[model samples]
Target: MSRRRPTVSTSPSWTVGDLTVHRVDEIPLPPATGAWLLPAATPDVVTGHDWLHPHFADAQGVLRLDSHSFAFVLDGLRVVVDTGIGNGKERANPAWHDLDTDYLGRLTSAGFPPDSVDLVILTHLHADHVGWNTRHENGRWVPTFPRARYVTSRTEREFWAGYAMDEARAQMFRDSVLPVEEAGLLDLVDTPADGATILPGLRLLPTPGHTPGHVAVELTSRGETAVITGDCVHHPVQFAAPAVGACVDIDPVRSEASRRALLGTLADTDTLVLGTHFAPPTAGRVVRHEGAYRLAPVPPVAPVAPAPVAP
Candidate 1:
């Protein structure tokens, strides 16, 4: 199932071999988010990659990043990758604080109501990525997907356990992450240097640097493959300059090495790269461009509604 065309949906999905990965819409991050998150990506750096325009950047070169999740049912498991910044969370970042978007409604429209999710994969413990892990209910935070097992890397969990976190991060854990763990629903896996296979065809590839325990998800079905970039590669600009990294990266050097390594394997391959923060037309393939790399955009298939049944 390598290199299949995308299938459209009201929720915007891409068909990888046999699986239809839905991009559940969350609120678009403020334009300022680009400058704050990836400071190294200057206007000059961005405008140089003309391919990024109209989709990934403006004519002014301000990057267009999004906050969304990928939902799909695979081998009887209904999965969600990286819950976006949830509603009603208290945060220091103005863009993410006290969001009131109808994220749950959008998820339900995509056929994945919170309760129906079987697994919640946390790429890392960043506030934006894990904000939807729980919901404010009855004056307390509770696991939104009470029935699902929330998973993240053990190393990632342990790193934060010992690190000194500011009030904001600690508050994020109190509201979004801790409740799931307290519910005995959090599962931490040991991701080695190579990676770890969590299911038959789903693998977690170690993509540290953005975070100590961060990982990018790899999905395969019918010989077709797609890799979800979980913060390791935020924007398409990185495809053109893998060295440019996120500002919050715990280890900038390792982040660069990891980015280089991941891009190296993906370049000129048939695998579809799904960017966690990429704006619309979010999925694409890595290609060699002017001695570096670029994402050849893959737009979602235009959605067609089901035909009416005879009365």
Candidate 2:
């Protein structure tokens, strides 16, 4: 008898008018810390293991999922949202150290040239979120997207600039962020007190808590809408247990409150939700399931799947 392998499902992509959306996949971390940001009541339930593993044995035994980075295309503009962990980053966790990304190839595979990106919108200045902001060239960190403008929240910029100096996080600023600023491509956006439209169909909505200056990007066009959530909510588990906050969260209480409110606002809307760290097919619709919210992945059908054969 031979063992059968689980079918691998590829991430989905879609176009909103002229904007082509790409979901870039990355490696996942096993749950080694018994307590997850959102833990399940029972160990066997898939919910608990979906986001993070509680033990190394469980992590090795279970099939780990991929994290995602999103790219938004609009009017001859290729806007990348949240650069995943980059190469050569010094962190306490070895897993996140010195990541070498083939994101340029990934972008080309998605049909957009590397230099074609017009804007790079970072939801925050977290290490994982800005890793790809630069690439190593001539033994130095330089802008990855040479021609693109990098936009980030002013509050986030100031916070990290100050926090990075005394904290271990300072290396991220010196390596990834400062270079972008020095290149004159960094744009500091004012944290909108009330939601404000940044582009024709794009709006910036305040959803502070994961970080002091964190904001969610809302896109709308011809009755279609989607919200690109950064770390405002890390995993699907938070939908049911909104109070659960990741250990890295700056303000757990505020993060909890913000999660509940954002979930509620989209609970009844047709907005397509995009999560930065969400598993493959990161783009989805939020639905009420089993008395709580759940993400229903948007199925990719145009690219046909292999037909099954009888044994």
Candidate 3:
């Protein structure tokens, strides 16, 4: 499960028409072997895919899922979709418990300082996604982006408000989620009937089921479209086998349906995709590979432009 990462640009930027998007990474997780994370993502299947190699999966067929975030800069607004796992926390999972990283520094490297963020969206308040919503401060947790309005669906916040089934979930809610609520910066928004338009070009599309109210952030400008997949579909292996649900998915059945629908809408189109947990060169387009689908990673040198997706 060792991840031998190659040297690559940490902040890989994308231009979706006028809006600029940057990938800010937190941690490069060690590879998960043979459905350790997804039941159908076995070594044989991963090795056979061919397309996942050297990017999603290694030469030996180990899968690496990163905890990362996307910063979208449009007009005068700087919004971050899904903050990566933050430092200093207690968790049932040892890898994520009591740790530290240069996530904030990388955000600054991506031209987004903590204070510069106007809005921070929690796609769903999972440990990895919402960890950076707050930070440890003087024996307490505080909103990391103090000036930003931390946004989440009312359904999501309300569901997690009472989610104390396990110690880790309780601690995560305590340290990462509630502080934003206490700060008076937590904007519990209702998912719009049409779509939640944060600004003119950016939208939040409700693609629930990974969590009760998970959302995928969409960016559209000057006739181009891009989507930030927030756990709707995590690893690219799911692209070829949509039925393979993640262990962390709250409702595998619902998550599978959501994944299929999301892929159906995105397949063989110009819409650029940025996976929340996809490995290096994370941005790409969904294309029909044989009969199934695949996340053809956008080449680091130059992306292959596909046909314009219908708006």
Q: Which 10-residue span in candidate 1 carries the lowest summed lDDT? A: 302-311
**Which residue runs of candidate 2 sit more than 4 Å off their true CA positions?**
1-11, 31-65, 164-167, 301-311
The per-residue C-alpha lDDT of model 3 at residue 160 equals 70
Range of the 10 consecutive residues with the lowest summed lDDT in candidate 3: 302-311
TM-score per candidate: 0.94, 0.82, 0.90
TM-score of 2: 0.82
- Runs of candidate 1 with Cα error greater than 4 angstroms are 1-9, 304-311
- Candidate 3 accuracy as TM-score: 0.90
Candidates 1 and 2 compared by lDDT, better number: 1
lDDT of 3 by residue, 1-311 (tens): 99444333347778888766878889887665235667678788888898998888887778878888988677777788988778988887776777789999878766677888888888898888888998887888989999899888888888776665587788888888878888899887788646688778878888777888888888999999999999998889889988988887888898999889889989999999999889888989999987789887775433222211112
> Best-fitting candidate, measured by lDDT?
1
**Which stretches in model 3 have alpha-carbon errors above 4 Å?**
1-10, 192-194, 300-311
Query: Which has the higher TM-score value, candidate number 1 or candidate number 2?
Result: 1
Q: Which pairs of residues collide in candidate 3?
A: none
Error of 1 at 171 (Å): 0.1
Better of 2 and 3 by lDDT: 3
Query: Which candidate ranks first by TM-score, i.e. highest?
Result: 1
